[model samples]
Target: MLKPYNKKPLSYAKQVHHLQSKGLSIHNVAWAEGILAKYGYYRLSAYWYPYRIRSGNNVLDRFKPGTSFEKIVQLYEFDTELRLQIFGAIEIIETFYERN
Candidate 1:
């Protein structure tokens, strides 16, 4: 069965507020807002998933204790860089094979 999506879209400021309400520590509001604006909340949420509180097989909506927003940003940055590096390597490999 299919269900309708009931969640509403939130602005960047509201997204920050939501995270704070969920127990995420935002050391810099402006920086967090900027990241959210650039990447959108959905993309950044993946980075913060590990920081969320969990019990057994169920993940809660709230974050774990001491889960900082800056750490989430760092994780996203690291993942982006890692993906770029991996793609660069693949491109190089393809180029080498084509010349042979």
Candidate 2:
């Protein structure tokens, strides 16, 4: 469901909500973009192929010096599902900020 990596981060929670609203899974929210390329088919599949999957830590390692996402995850010991929740909350707060 993801597009190629972009220069910036997309909305994790917005993607989650968009996917879930369509009865799709958010397991790959961090990586997937939920972009409908053609015929409404998401580029990626729902299957969590271990071989093609990378751990969240790898993504975290690339965090910018001042980013708080890693710290938040560490503070909460967020597991897969919990990470989604935390990311969702972060998205909400960011959305609120952007609108103001």
User: Which has the greatest lDDT?
Assistant: 1
What is the lDDT for 39 in model 1?
87
Error of 2 at 54 (Å): 27
Q: How many steric overlaps does candidate 2 have? A: 2
Candidates in order have lDDT scores of 0.92, 0.42
Spell out the clash pairs found in candidate 1: none
Error of 1 at 93 (Å): 0.9
Tens-place lDDT per residue, model 1, 1-100, is 8899998888889999999999999988888899899988989888899888898999999999999988888889999999999999999999999999
**Top candidate by TM-score:** 1
